[model samples]
Target chain A: MSPARLFQGGLVVVAAALAVYPFFGTGYGVRALLQLFMWIALAGSWNLISGLTGYVSFGHVAFFGAGAYTAAILITNAGWSWPLACAAAGVAACGLALLIGYPCLRLKGPYFAIAMLGLNEVLRALVSYFEGLTGGGSGLSLPTLQASVPIYYVMGLCAAAVTALTYVIITSRFGLRLMTIREDEVAAEAMGIDTARHKLYAFLLSAVGPGIVGGLAARDQGYIEPISVFPLATTITMIVMVLFGGKGTVWGPVLGAVILFVSQEVVWARFPYVHQLLFGAIIVAVVLLMPRGVLGILQIKYRLPRTV
Target chain B: MNVVITPAMIAQVVISGLLSGTLYAMVALGLALIFGVMRVINIAHGPMLMLGAYVTFFLYSAFGVNPYLTLPASMAVLFVLGMLLERTLVFRVVDAPELSSLLLTFGISIALVNLAQLAFTSDLRAVEFLTGSFVIGPVAVSKPRIVAFAFAAIITAAAFLFLRNTKLGKAIRATSQSRDVAMVCGINVGRIHLITFGFAAALAAAGGTLIAVIVAIQPEMGQIWTFKSFLVIVLGGAGNYPGALVGGMLLGLIEQLASLFLTTQLSEAVAYVLLVLVLLIRPTGILGGRST
Candidate 1:
């Protein structure tokens, strides 16, 4: 068999193992893997726009929070089922992205980043102010569901779907245009690429996985709050994960999410007091030493596949 | 719910707003100086300001030192800290994409905030140097606030004078205009960058020390000031000093008036709404024709 085929077969085996692990594994093990899958989905979504297009959004949490809120409101206020509400959450987030992305994508560099940051704060305030609907700062609780196994399966599926979509994007002409924009947007426009339209599309695509994952997370937690759903730390973690693994590559976010999530879990269990500080140091070190990330380094040093 | 709108109430809000506005201008001025000179956004500005407040709090609590006297010490400490950071971390990313400096400073900010939490707990601290409020025609002004505003105004004026007249300040402005030209003109651009960052940090420290006496100080309190500073600079125009002052005052007045009509949380959103409006309508800011 060809080396690529062998690698593909190995991946299939790993996926199979992950798919059935919940049946035999301890509850703690299942919960841990579920969280891992969620991070992979979230990081993959972030990587779709930011890593691919080099448009670093500082408030990607807006989408997550929006999705979570949508799902929660739909479940409690409208008496919708979890599956339908989660799908609606993704649609709501996409609508938000399209609306905001049109004007915000016009901004370049720090301006765009700062605008996104302001966007998160604005959305958070708006959610908090609508006390009748959102329960204000006290947060909202959904009906309890004894369905961790189902959640785990759904989250795993979402992660796999995002990874597959990323692979498809990486291999498509659309992704080429995004790479061109990342390299030199003016040059891309000169080459007849609709930079604005393309960026908006990428931004829209990127909001979906996070939105669905957020809905799932809200359901899993059985409670939702603006602060919990819209935390800046979530964006930071996703950004760090993508950067740490290797941005602009198909498999980088997956690798990064797995490694960083496991490390975080281990460190949190051992030294909860110093976890945040240590994480900060890790971020600084990552920026300074591995700006291109681990996959980037391997690709350069060992002639690994560029997309992978 | 027929609330009366009195002239005295308006006057009181306006006076307090302008007072806080002066301090806001100082913080924005610091941010303007750094971005103007280096083209790098210092996300850690808030954390540095927090450190300055912590410094003042510790000095006042430990040695019974006057909070005003601790201003110079805070400024000096942050100046050295800023210079060291510029030399070590910021300089490396000076020419990288704006994202690099932003993320780098963000990392520094996280580290600093968490370190502060570990060392000084998250409890709020305040300096009660002046407790009385003097009434002038139904507009009562707190003594400490008045003092802070006075210092803010004087320091801002002094900063303008330095930029307008001094040799080092000229070099700094020269670098801001065109780094290559400044270098060709025999100016040490690196040294100017170093001094610009340190000077900016010192200004933020001054604002921190002054405001520490008026409000409760905490490790996370700097985040709001950072947002406020960004709003002021955005409204004023990046790197425009006079524009920043005007913008800061406008924001202060707007916030004070907003609280009258909306909840405090919604009032806080006013800055963000104003920010979005400014960005969409006038990206060059209210003071037009400035290049970002």
Candidate 2:
């Protein structure tokens, strides 16, 4: 078999092992699995828009928070089931992407990023203000289920699906259009690509994974707050992870997310207080020393173009 | 929500907002200048201000120096720090793609905030001021607010003049206009960036000195102030110095007015909503704030 086939086989093996790990694994192992899976999902989603399209989204967590909030409200107030609430929340996040993305994506480069940053702040403030619904700053608690086993698998599945979707999107014609747009929006427009529509499509696609995973994670965690769900650190983490992994490539974000997440978990476990400083230092060093990330060292063909 | 807004109440609110807005504009000048010239969205802008505030706070509490007296010292310290950051970190990615710089500055911000947290322990600190509020016509203004506003106005005017009159200021402007053109004209663009970033940091410290008098200071306050500074510049026009001036006041008035009828949180969201609306309607901003 070719290298591609060999890689595919390896993936299949890992997936099978992951599928059965809960049965034999310790509780700690299962917990770590969920955390790693969550980062992969978040990073992959970010990579779709920011890495591939060159539009750095600083407010992607707004969608995650939106999904989490939606599901939380529905499950708690309306007594909806987890599956129905999560699905609806996923739909809500997509709708939000379309609404915010269409107008915001019209902007180019730094403008788009800063605008999105502002959008996240606005969402957090709104969440805090609407005390009755989002439980204000005190936050809402989901009825704790004794089993987080389902959440772990659901997150794993979502991460896998998102990775697969990224591959599909990047290899397709739509992906090329996005790449072209990223290179130069005006040139892409002149070349007959509907830059706006392609960007919007990328934005919408990216929003879904985070939305779904957010719902699952919220249900599993059993309590959610605006501060926890909509952390500015969340947006920064996703960006750094995808960038660290090799943003445009299929395996890059997943690889980056897992490595960074594990490293962070370890570092935080030992040093604890220094994690933020170290994370910040890591980002600064990466931007200064190696903009291409680990995949760059591997001589990957799908590295992001170095166009500011 | 049903708070009746008499004209007197509006006057008082606007007066205080305008006072704070002046100091905000001072802080924003450094931000607008750095981003306008360097394309570096200094995620560390707020933390820089925090540093300035802390610097002044310690100087005031440890010694008997007035807060205003600490402004120049804060500026000097911050300027050196700014110069160091530019030469070391910012200069590397100054010419790279936008993504790298955005994330890099953000990292600097996180590092600085955490450093502050580690050093200062996330406790809220404020400069103690025993000055009393004085009534002016129908509105009352605090003594510190007036003093802060006076400093803000003076610094702003001085910066405006420096940019127009000084040779180095011209070099900075020339570089902001086009780095290549400035280099071609025998101006050291890199050196100008060093100076500009330093000047920007000093201005941030100056603003911090005044802000320390008016508001409570904390480590996490950096992100919101940085974003708010961005909002001000965006509203006024990003590269326009005068735009920062107008935008700061505009933001303050909008927030105060909104709070008159809406919840405090709702009023805060108004800026973000306006930001989106502005981007949709006029990405260049109302003042046509292009880099040139």
Candidate 3:
């Protein structure tokens, strides 16, 4: 069998293990697995825009909160089913990305990133200031679900789906366009690619996962606050994960998310107070020493093609 | 209800806005100077400012050091920290893509903010100052605010004068214009970079020290200040100090006026709203035309 086939089989086995572990495990184990899958989906989503297109967004929590709030509002006001609300939330988030991305995607380099940062703050303030609609600082809480299992599987499916989508994108013409744009936008435009439109597509594509995940997680947790949902730390976490695993690759985000998220969970469980310090140190070390991330380092060692 | 616009109200608002605006300009100048010369966005800037405030608080409350005297101490401390960070970390990625320095500084920011939380325990601390509200015509003026503003303005002016007139300032200016040209002219561009970062850090610290005189000091306060500083510098233009002053004052006045019509929560977001508009209409910032 080819090595590529073996690698595919390895992925299948990992998925199988993830799928069955909940059944064999206790409730805490399942909850942690759910968190891992959430991180995977979140990090994968971030990798799509920032990793593939090199347009790092500092305000993705805006989309997450948008989705979460949209879902909460729909269910409470319109009597919508939770599942439909989740789907609508995804649409809502995509619409937002489209609206903001059209204007913001025109900015190049750090300006684009910081503009997104400003957008997040604007959205958060808007949500709270319109207290009559969003419950203001008190935030919105949805009806509780008895089982966490459904969210686990939904999040797992999302993680799997995003990974598969990333693989497909990596192999597709659209994905090549994205990486090319990242490499050199001026040259890409010179070569006839619509850099603005493609970036918007990537940004929109990346947003849906976080949107859906936020909706599901909000419902499962039975509560949502603007501060909790739209924390700036979420953006930092996703960026660091993608950067750590190796950006711009199909496998990089997954690798980065699993290692970093799992380790963080472990550290948080053991030494909650020191986790942030640890996380910050890791970020410094990674950017300073292992900037290529784990996969990048491995690729460099073996002299592998960056795209593949 | 067309409530009559009173001249006294206008005087009050103008005084309050200008007072806060000077502090904003002081902080923004530091950020602008570093970005102007180094081309690195120091995300850790807010935390550094917080440190300055914290230093002032501890000194004033603990040892009875004059709050004004904390300015020099804060500057000295931040200068050392800045030099050390520049030599060790920032210079490592001085030529890498812009994202590298951003990420590096972001990491440092997270580390600093969290460590501050751990050390200070998130309690709100304010420097105790004797207060008297002095009236000028129809307006009530805060004495501490007036004094802090004056002190901050003096420091900012001294900094500008130094940059414009001094021999070392010329070297730094030459480096900002073109690092290679500065090198060719035997300016020791590396040393200038180090000194410029240290000086910028000191400026930011001085801003923090002055702010400690009037406002509440806390660990998390840095985030908003950092955001404001960035908005100011970006508005004025990336490397334009005077532009930062204008942008800072503009932001302060806008926020003050906006609070009259909008909720303070909403008003707090005005900087970002203006930022988005500026980026869309004039990405060079309000005064950044043709500079980039």
Candidate 4:
């Protein structure tokens, strides 16, 4: 087999192992693996828009929060099931992306980032203000469900599906257009790539994974709150993970999420208080030093295939 | 929500809003200055203010120093911190893509806020040096707010005067207009960038010190202030100095008036909503001629 085929086979083997390992693993192991999958999905989704298009969203947590709330409300108030509520959550998140993205995409670079930051605050405030629906800052609780196993399986699938989607997109002409836009948007537009439409598609696609993941995670936890669901730290962590793994690449975000999440778990277990501080320091060092990320270095130094 | 708004009530809200607006302008001054001169958004702007507030809080609580007297201390501390950050981190990314600087500053902010949390324990601290509200005709004003407003006005005036009259200020202005041309004209652009960052930080420190007198200060408080400052700069226009002052006041007034009809939560959200709307409607801001 070619190296690409070998790599693809390796991924399938890993996925198969992950899908079955929970059956033989401890509850704690399953729980941890579930969270790892969640982060991979979130990071992968973020990479779709930010990594590929260079539009760093400082407030992507808003979509996650929106999705969580939507799913929680549907399950609690409307008597919807977990799977259906999560699907509706994805749809709701897409609608929000459309509303916020149209206006926000007009602003380029840092302005877009800052506006998204503002959007997160706006959504948080709105969620809190409408105390009737979201339970305000006190948060909302879902009906107790013994659905951890199901959530784990779905999250694992999401992680795998999002990675597969990224790989497909990276090899497609549409992905080329996105990379072009990232390089020089004006040049991309001049080349007759519908930058706006392509960007919107990417933005909408990016919103779905987080939406579904948020719903799954919320159901797993059995509780949801504005602060818990929409923390700035969540956005920063996803961004750092993508940057760490290798942004704009198929496997980069997945690698980043896995390594960072495990390290974060270890750090949290050992030094909970200083982990955030260390995380911040790491972000600073990353930007200053290896901004191209681990994969970027590997690709340049060892001539690794970009697709893998 | 059904409370009637009489003229006196309106007067009180407006007067209080304007008082708070001065402090808003004070916080925004440094951000406007840095962006205007360097075109680099300082994401760490809020943490610098938080540091200032903490400095003032410690001085007042530990040494029994008057809160007003601690302003210079906070400003000086922030000034050095700003210079060091700019020289070490910001200087490397000054000419890089705008995203690099923003991310760098964001990292700096995270580190600073977390460092503060480790040191200060996230306790909310305030200096109630001047208390009680005095009535003036129909409206009443808090003494701390009046003092804060006065200091804000004085500092803003001084900043305006310095930018208008000093040779160094002229160099800074020239650099902001066109860095290459300014460099050709014998202005040290590197030094100006350093000074501008420090100067902006010092301004934020002053704003924070004044803020400590009026409200509770905590490590995480800087994020909201940073957002407010960004809104002010965007509303006033990027790279427009005087516009920042106006934008700050406008945001303050809008927030205060919004509270009359909306819940406190919605009112807080109003600032962000306004930020998005302003960004979409007028990216250049009212007085801003520089393209964002």
Best by TM-score: 4
TM-score of chain A of 4: 0.96
Looking at model 1, the pairs that clash are: none
Give the range of the ten consecutive residues with the poorest summed lDDT in model 1 chain B.
B283-292
- Model 3 chain B is weakest, by summed lDDT over 10 consecutive residues, at B283-292
CAPRI rating of model 3: medium
- State the fnat of model 1: 0.46
Residue-level lDDT of model 3, residues A254-296, one tens digit each, is 8888888888766667876666676677777887898779999
Query: Interface root-mean-square deviation for each candidate?
Result: 1.7, 1.3, 1.7, 1.4
DockQ of each: 0.57, 0.75, 0.56, 0.66
Question: Which candidate do you rate higher for lDDT, 3 or 4?
Answer: 4
Q: What digit string (tens of lDDT, one per residue) describes model 1 on residues B247-273?
A: 889898888888878887788789887
- Output the better candidate (3/4) by DockQ: 4
Q: Which residues of candidate 3, in runs, are more than 4 Å off?
A: A20-24, A302-308, B1-4, B290-292
Estimate, for each residue in B1-292, the C-alpha lDDT of model 3 and write its tens digit.
Answer: 2455688877777778887888888888877777877888788888899989988999999998989988899999999998998998888878876667777887888788888888988889989874788887898887888888898889888877887899998887788788888899999988998998898888888878888877889887787777788888777777766788888788878777776667778887888777777767777777865231
Model 2 Cα shift for residue A112 (angstroms): 2.1
- Largest DockQ belongs to which candidate? 2
The digit string of per-residue lDDT tens for model 4 on B65-178 reads 999999899999999999999999999888876666777888888889989999999878878899998888988898898999999999988988898889988888888889
Candidate 3 pairs with clashing backbones: none
Candidate 4 C-alpha lDDT tens digits along A62-143: 8888889999999999999999999899899999998878777876656777777777888888988899988998999999
* Better structure of 1 and 2 per DockQ: 2
Q: Estimate each model's TM-score.
A: 0.96, 0.95, 0.95, 0.97
Q: How well is each residue in B89-163 modelled by candidate 2, as lDDT tens digits? A: 998888777878888888898999989989988888989874788887888888888999888989988998898
